[model samples]
Target: MVKSGKTKKKYHKPTKPHHHLNPPPAQANKPISVKTLPAHLVLEILYRTPVKSLVRFKSVSKSWFALINHPTFIKMHLDFNTSKNDKNKLICSCGYGTFIDIALLSLSEEPMNVLRINKDFTERPNYPRKINFRDFSKNMVLAGSVNGIVCLSHSEEMSERFVVLWNPSICCWCPIALVETKSWDNMSVGIGFDEVINDYKVICIVPEFRFEDYGWSRIEVYSTNQGSWEDVDKKGKIHFRPNTDLNHCNFIVNGVPYWAGLDLRPGYVDVLGRIDPFTGLFKKIEHPKHVRNEITRVNPVKLRESVAALIQSPGDYPNNVIDLYLLDENTTKWTKMYSIGPLVSGNVCEEMQIPQCFSTGEIILETWTWDTDQDHVTDLDLVHNIYDPKTKLVLHINHMQALHPCWYESYSHVESLVCIKGMVQIGKEHRDKKTKPKMKNWTEFLSKEFDSVLHL
Candidate 1:
């Protein structure tokens, strides 16, 4: 329902900025310098402040600046904010009409607006924000989002496709080098955060075709710290392509990017695949075997536990019922967590994509591609429903109405002060970049047997 228009990007101007994050309400009426505050109090205040506010705090004092920019403090802020229920904000994708608007949705009582990913950026010259990526909206695809950085990939007029890593919190972005492969058209790309090394890695999966069949998948990993891409392994036998669906439940857990495995070799393939960015190899795990006939109806997701799958209940209840199976990272065993529903209210849960859950157990559900006379909504925009399992009530938040085939997608994102390295001026200078571009063809596409999707 978010119409693509010539709207300028607007940052969330926190409604209650009347009181600064540093100076609490007790000192709200006066302009007290942060230097006057005690060291312990200053660190505590800065840790709780939002990223946008913390970015400006770099100008307060040399010590305050050093403290905020320090790796210890940044990690402290990210860890602290990760638990705050109200800190949750969703980066939901609006349709690609003339352009795509990746809007941020708040679970709290904040107003909603378009993120405006367009050509006009800020005052900095050659900033990446100025690039009009929407010109190729047809092939514009989201690789993945990790921490607070979202990586996007698109081919410019059938040329080679490149990757761009963006951190909207600080309005700083950098484009990763273009990935070229002999089987370029069949490659699947994803970006993930390797928490073990504190580095972000971009991975590409390509199935090598030989002897009239797919021999093996050649997997490559790009490390931000090293600023280059390299093959993860020479013999990756389970080199199946990960799911690349824009609306599927592909998520990253503990620095590993997981997508349901989809192989085109004409036999039964594993249901899930997880890549180890550090090691060049990966292992595939089967879906929860306890689901019986409901195995094919299951989807992998990150639940309250580390890695989990949502299984569609076999019962023909009034509404869709989903069960959760948490995979123990240590033991690699599935444990049944809970069920999603039992006709709690509406019957439109079948097409629900991702149900983003805040730290407070409040769930926001977005559904589409179905008709509903229960709500009497005559238009096409999916109803933004809030279902708090604790309260057991579905809160309807109907607003926008767009065309029938609106391709909006949403993913749960946690804001962080993560910074991108090798920042480049993105303007006319990019045209000078050259690479060994390979001819791509549409004959090689990931087999859509089980509808696996991309995750990072």
Candidate 2:
């Protein structure tokens, strides 16, 4: 019928079907052109999510990875996490020889719970087993605790010996070899996370090295995964030891470690050290500013995730307290936060006290009473004062009279036994939920267990 002279139209071979059904139009139900939201709003949403989700989102895109790793963003996220329910445990060890009396306290709720974990345990055949220093012929001291792992160092004949990693939860003990021979005079300890390897590391600093003699500091780092220790060569000509007395605690913020020491003068200044868990490299970070007092002791406490807090008393005595500064991760500048109340109010606050800081905004302070007017500060007894910064109220007050006998015996030189403020809280949990519970808090449950050990 139709003898068309015009060439018939030919359709090209069918390509792969993006969608197959009733052969709908190509642009059927296209994804909506979602408008990009402002970065602030996006950050707010990301910040509200749990740390697990935020960490997972880091791998979504290069933009996200860079954003999350940014110093400012890291600080904000850390602060938000710190404001949540944070639990910290305080451990106090007293005794010169092997038979040291160790006391454990829980700083969770308003009223602090103090439990002495020296009792005997049926599960542990070595109930209240006397830690014999004579066996090793060296005296051991509890250096510090991190994530429920305790560091213990001992010395004999003026030789600083090995350090051990003791986990109180499982009663498992792993001793690290003595990597250095220097005395423990100006030494401090800290543990932190390594994001690159997803493992934990412990750093020990002995400020006993002489800059004029060696022109370098003795910085040591330990990794759990590697099961070894290595020396960190960070400084060029700056001397760490012999410049000033080691006063502050070693603090860990956002997985980085830091401590307080003197700069050129006898005055105090903050010193930062980054531990590369992979290479075990310890490099010194520039101090933001120097404090006034020669005895400017820094109490570095973790107020939140990215916030490393410092409470510096202008002078050695507690009276001249001025400002509490929070360090910014991005600028690395210290910003003055709220002023803390007087160290002593003529209230129940006493001498030989330690302020136990937690991310929960609560400070667990240990106080002792002694006649300052007397010849020697020997008759001091122990007490605890718990304060909540949020409510600005005193939560609990208790006397640690059981530890008085040990204190009196060791009070010959109160300065050496004084616990510094930069000490990290033991039994702290990691951001990873998969990790095991490091702190057992066995004080309540294992009271009978530890009691038998001491009696034996």
Candidate 3:
């Protein structure tokens, strides 16, 4: 009776023979430590990750933190990215007065019918303080960007104005002390890196008050390594076209700042005045061809290994074509690279600014244009064109009219982990007092800036 009362034996379900035949790999449950990875493999992994990821990984462990912050690692990562033909992004600053808007546009090989607003600058950490365009009466201009650091200055009538050096990647920024110059009129500033000294520099050109008709300009340079401004040794005898629109005059190419020089003479030769920040030498390069009697705009851009000029003809609205010419580094000969457009059928290009051209033959250009239905008197629309020289394929990217102005500032930037403050020591006292605030999580910050802008 006791045996009968015992519970019936539970039926056992048969397991698959394969399940018992093979157990999980030993390393499956126990994740391999990153420390166990070969050093070269680890470095390769870090190099491929985005800068924001590297910044956060600095907290993973002391070893990782040190490695991420190490100067050697930083340089290697930058080099790797630069060599990999990474897509260059366009950073655009629009709006005027207190409501200035900043955005980033990601360029892709895939044809895009519409230009998507990438990231808004307002939502970014360490962005320069907003100034009322009405109060200042001037739009903020991006002086130049080098190694992911952008120098921003607002139009202030004062002889001395504040300039901000910002690293959007790390969200770090430092304001250079008030830059004092002879005249704010016709003044231009540019930022560039010096490979020899491994330093970053800011070059300022201020018109010298003079009676003579010949336009004269003075040069002052601020070295990040020195953390101070010094008059260029050959400051005198510097000449720039009087009344030059400094806003569009300066750009960086191959670690040098090139300022557009007005043809003071009757001859219509466009000249680019280049300054080597390291040696502080100034030289002028003549345009590819003497543009005959036409109002031409010359944009000096870095094209692969050498500097190239993107020249627009008849510099007025409703233009039909653009000429690209690359400079020979050794001979200084300007060779015609490609003739872009008869653009999109209905669009009339008013102005074109070429930011960057890759060795892969893709050229990024910002154009201000108007639809054929719209007259020249109408406001020009902002358009971005990605032209493939090889295939002559043009991808027209139309953006929101509200976000882009007739005169927005744009720069081509490569991603880097460079520290803004580390580029050059600001003063010890200034550095201690003006430490950059911590940035919000990049993923979260980007989402907020782009959520409303990007619908696709």
Best by lDDT: 3
The weakest ten consecutive residues by lDDT in model 1 span 447-456
Q: Give per-residue CA lDDT, model 3, range 354-434, as digits (tens).
A: 755654557776677665554444555666667877688877655533444533655566678888444333223233356
lDDT of 1 by residue, 1-456 (tens): 998979898898767647555766667787656545554565678778878898887787654455565566667787777767577666665654454566666655443443555433334434344443333233445556677777666643322455667666776667665555444555566677777778888876666667554645667677889898765556545646555443222666655667676665556565787778767567777777753443236667655427777666545544367666779776778888667765335433345644444445555555653445776544444555666667677676544223113435445566788786765433333456568654363112322321121110
Q: Give residue 84's error in model 2 in angstroms.
A: 7.9
Residue ranges of candidate 1 with Cα displaced over 4 Å: 1-35, 111-114, 118-139, 155-159, 209-215, 235-239, 244-249, 263-266, 290-296, 316-319, 342-350, 355-363, 369-381, 398-407, 424-456
Clashing pairs for predicted structure model 1, backbone only: 243-452, 243-453, 243-454, 244-453, 244-454
Error of 1 at 217 (Å): 2.5
Worst ten-residue run, lDDT, model 2?
409-418
- Best by TM-score, which number? 3
The local distance difference test score of each candidate is 0.59, 0.48, 0.62
Give the TM-score comparing model 3 with the true structure, all chains together.
0.71
